[model samples]
Target: MLKPQRPLKLLIIDDSPDFQLLIKTYLEDFGIVCLFATDVVQATSTAVREQPNLILLDIGLPGGGGLLLLERLRANLRTAKVPVIVITAQTTDGLESKARFQGAEEFLHKPVEKDVLIDTLRRVLSRPPTQQA
Candidate 1:
């Protein structure tokens, strides 16, 4: 269990104001710290400086999109091993597999349910940082 003295942090990179508020409020209610980045530039800087325990990324953004961000994160040694969960509005086939291949450990469609969000977070956070990869 994560204690207040050492909370698990999640960086959510999305362009939606409503989503930012909703996710932040929900996660904070359960003692998880949430950071917001509305764009690629901010997301990159925050990921480097804050070094959040997890990243929840949205694929549709103003700039190069979430896939590009995921690639960048994977290339950067500092954040390469951090678990990234991709969330998006699209429900196209093979999206999840592609996300995993591109370095996202999980994928969620838009309007993510509270229970699913919490469960995924807990499960991923509880896993060993480096498995037999």
Candidate 2:
């Protein structure tokens, strides 16, 4: 017999309320435990306090940006190993590489579909902790 899989905890760091709700609703059916933070402060606090299994971070934000948040997250010992999947509407040149270099485990453009989101989440989580970055 196999042990049941635990519900995956996810933190979504996006300033848009609509986007947050969309992601939560889309992922709820899969039994993932989703949390939200609308800005840099909230994101940072939540990342440390909640210690989510994965984070879906958006690039554009108020009071600093996702890159800054990512850097801070990486620096924090509490949440440093958490796998981060970068999400953004701003698909500027070299953004993906920049994110990866900053320790993002994966990158996904905004308006992501359910299947892609699920697949990416599983892929990131399945990787060993050392390989998450």
Candidate 3:
């Protein structure tokens, strides 16, 4: 008999309670354990402490913003290997590319549909982690 698998822990960094609730509902249905943080400070500490398997990040956060937190996460050894999917309402030029350049595995717009969000998460998490030199 095979051992039971542990649920994947997903950290969601977003400022909106509505968005958090929506995402939590979507992910929990699939047995993903959802953790949350509303701002850069909370996001940073939670991420380092929890060491989640993946992160769903929102760009426009209070405190220092999501990009800054992403950079810090990338720099930190504990959370550096975790995959990050950036979901944001901002449509400013080059934001997506910037997030990717800063180490986000995927970029998604706000109001992400359930199917799209699920597919993106699957794709990103399925890929092997990049080797650090």
Candidate 4:
């Protein structure tokens, strides 16, 4: 008999420890393995090592911001096609457009509604690879 594949891995890149805890707790029931990174350096390294199925990125990371990291991720073949959702408080002019143009699957505002976050993630994950960024 063949073994079952593991559940998807998710990485959350945010500066807040509390938010990381909240995301972990909320997503645990979905059978996802959650990883945290408080800054770009760690986020980059973790992304390379873990190669998560999805990434929830905060725009205002320390060392390097989400946009920079997104660029780096897009530049790398291994991580370039991974789906990413930008969840951030900094929803300024054109940020969402920029995020989408930079290859984010979605851009969600901070204080994300629990249902919205879960639903968006589910929808994104369910789509075919051709439809994903």
Q: Write the per-residue lDDT of candidate 4 for residues 38-108, one digit (tens) a residue.
A: 99999999999999999999999999799999999999888988999999999589999999999999999
lDDT of 2: 0.89
TM-score of 4: 0.94
| Cα distance off (Å), candidate 2, residue 24 | 1.0
Off by over 4 Å in 2: 1-4
How many Å off is the CA of 69 in candidate 1? 0.4
lDDT of 2 at 81: 93
lDDT of 1 by residue, 92-113 (tens): 8887888888889888998899
TM-score of each: 0.92, 0.94, 0.94, 0.94
Superior candidate under lDDT, 2 versus 4: 4
lDDT of each: 0.85, 0.89, 0.88, 0.89
Give the Cα-based TM-score of candidate 3 against the true structure: 0.94
Candidate number of the best lDDT:
4
Q: For model 3, how does the per-residue alpha-carbon lDDT over 1-133 read when each residue is reduced to its tens digit?
A: 1111788899999999999999999876678888999999999999999999889999999998999999999999999899999999999999999999999999999889999998988888777777320
Question: What overall lDDT, based on C-alpha atoms, would model 1 receive against the true structure?
Answer: 0.85
lDDT (0-100) at residue 29 of candidate 4? 73
